[model samples]
Target: MDLVTLTVDVVIALWVVAVVVGIVRAIKARPPRLAPLPEQIRNRFEVGWERISGRFLYEPQWAVGEADSLVMSLLSARGQPLDHARLPREMQQARHDAAAAANGRPRDKTEAMRQVLLQYRTVFERNLGPKPRRTAPVPRREVA
Candidate 1:
């Protein structure tokens, strides 16, 4: 074959290999599915969610503690190690200061509370079961 034809062939072969590798990696990269939550634990998480959602706005300190408590509870129920639930050092200090400050400012407390809520949700979901699938909302049919 001519030099130009030989180069073209090589390039085509490389392109095909690249495409196949990309497809294979894409397939392997999919997240592993999580198991479903047990009914009892799901109920517990739901209750905790309600309490935190209700009180977080008005009572930031209490909400932060509640979030931590919820994570602890889930760990207890699952018989997991407790250290996994502990807040980071900075967060711990922030929480402590928030507690000590009489008439604590909500701004500082709110950031800590938000972190706690995020931690709780992550820990709760990890222990509870597989991630829930998100479904698209169904469109309503208009009557003619």
Candidate 2:
């Protein structure tokens, strides 16, 4: 065969091989499996928050501890990217503050605890969509 014809045939063969490989890959490809929060775990989160807000609202130390636990659980479940070490560092500091407060440190760390809660909430909301609204139904009065 002529040189030009031979080159054309080789290019055609390479194109065919590439097409076959692509088709095989497409056929074998599978979507990534997301680890969604299980219903039971979600229930635990709701209950934990309710307890913190209802009974521990005035107790800054307790509230921050509970919120921190919830945030950590969420991050663990969602498999958050750990490329930057900042988040973990912040979490560790928050945990230490909570411990200090729990041990009855002389200085009041309520403000620091509140900041931790705020940061935890921001992270939680960013990872898991918006938080569901928690509201009580109003009672309707019977008209005479």
Candidate 3:
């Protein structure tokens, strides 16, 4: 009823509305979960990974670049953002190291390239790895 009380109530109500709006906006802005990769595409990625790993011993730098490319391809198939900043943190780091190696930067050390390949593997498996099988539940036995 009082002027001071009314002013304080209005401020509190406005603050609450602002907070709710912010939360809703954040929820809407989040990216949707990636759908499962099709079997054919998954198989192709697996074969590519096999070749990359096989070549690692003989050509570490090339293998790392291939691995990064494979992961990016997988992400593309899944409709993920290709922008470096928009990619997942693990992917961004792997991509950075892969670029460095390809450009002959200091991080192009053999051991570092190996680590980059491993990082790419992590992303690859997360997106294309075998999904867990679901077993059917046993039916209940009838009482005698």
Candidate 4:
């Protein structure tokens, strides 16, 4: 529109942008408590809500659990035919055989299946580890 109107609008927009950026930077920096009202208040406004929600939500958690299950199933094979429960068991066996054809060396069928499983194993290896033992030291004898 007119120059006066556009300049006022530009000033207001600049002020709004400055406020937003200042707020974000304050949250990230966690400014000193000695500062005055607004800046001090801004320091407490931490932001990681999205990341916290992502890990806890149903779909993400379920997918992570499935990756864990796949790893467990593969490790159980350990280069042998897994004694899987029957029914689509025959079909799964055939699928493993077909996949072996694609690999340069013809892998043992179980190893072929385990390779598929290694994708999930990598996830388990990265994310989870065994719990530490609660080892208490034995009491020292008081010599006579």
Candidate 5:
């Protein structure tokens, strides 16, 4: 075979190898599918979320910290990436805001805490499923 033809064949082979390696790397980089949490665990997280949300009005800073912790716990329970660098953008931002609020860095710490709560809420809803609906108590009939 001519030198030029041999070189061309070698280049094609190298390109094919590179493509296959890239595909393999991409597949390995993807996160594994997360299994659904058990019903009891999910309910516990829901109750925790409610308490954290309720505390937000009275103690914004403390509530933000609790919310952050709860979110991290939920993610951990769900086998999610826990590293700050690997966490989703929204979660990263929420963590940042929570830290800021806890450290009293922001001028409007309450507002910052509120945003953090909202971001964490999104994460909670996504991972723990939607918040359960609360039905109003039915009125009792008067005795005749």
Candidate 6:
């Protein structure tokens, strides 16, 4: 019984120490330097901006759908890359599309963003093709 009590006390003490350490770390940690956050967020916009070769825009899944033509049209009106000059409008349209996708039922906004991301991921998979490549079957050799 005494052993159990001592173990419990040690566990509690560990938890308290952990919480204090977390608090100290949080206070001392510096916030990451970032560009000013835009007023709105667009679907897959961030992903595209971050990629080296830019897998976000050219890939199949990230490719805009028929319903998402508004976005493409807007991008076309701007320049090939949809330059940051029109970021505000682009973000607005993205939010509009997000709302349209949600329909009537209330959903988590983050989930909507994730859905948009997944849509692009599907495009990526389609464009990239299956992971394991298929090869032509070889004819069986006859035993000598």
Q: Tens digits of per-residue lDDT for model 4 on 2-107? A: 9999999999999999999999987755522322223322222212222322443344333334444443343332222333432123334434543553453543
The TM-scores of all predictions, comma-separated, are 0.46, 0.46, 0.71, 0.27, 0.74, 0.23
Give the CA lDDT, 0 to 100, for residue 23 in model 5.
100
Residue 115 of candidate 2: its Cα lDDT?
Answer: 65
* Predicted candidate 3 versus true structure: per-residue lDDT over 94-129, tens digit per residue: 877777766665554787788888999998988775
Q: Which candidate, 2 or 6, has the higher lDDT? A: 2
Across 98-125, the per-residue lDDT of candidate 6 in tens digits comes to 5555553444543454566554344333
Q: Name model 1 segments beyond 4 Å from true.
A: 1-37, 83-106, 131-144
Candidate 3 RMSD computed on C-alpha atoms after optimal superposition onto the true structure:
4.8
Clashing pairs in 3: none
The list of candidate 2 runs beyond 4 A from truth reads 1-34, 81-108, 130-144
lDDT head-to-head 1 vs 6, winner = 1
Better of 2 and 5 by TM-score: 5
**By TM-score, how accurate is candidate 6?**
0.23
> TM-score for model 2?
0.46
User: What is the overall TM-score of model 5 with all chains considered together?
Assistant: 0.74
In model 1, the worst 10-residue window by lDDT is 81-90
Candidate 4 clashing pairs? none
What are the lDDT scores of the predictions, listed in order? Answer: 0.64, 0.66, 0.84, 0.42, 0.83, 0.46
lDDT per residue (tens digit) for residues 23-123 in model 1: 99887555334445677677878788788868877886677677667766665565543452343343345445445542546566567566556655665
Ranking by TM-score: 5, 3, 1, 2, 4, 6
Report lDDT (Cα) of residue 75, candidate 6: 44
Q: What is the total number of backbone clashes in candidate 1?
A: 2
Model 2 poorest ten-residue lDDT run:
80-89
Check candidate 6 and list the clashing pairs.
60-123, 61-120, 61-123, 61-124, 62-120
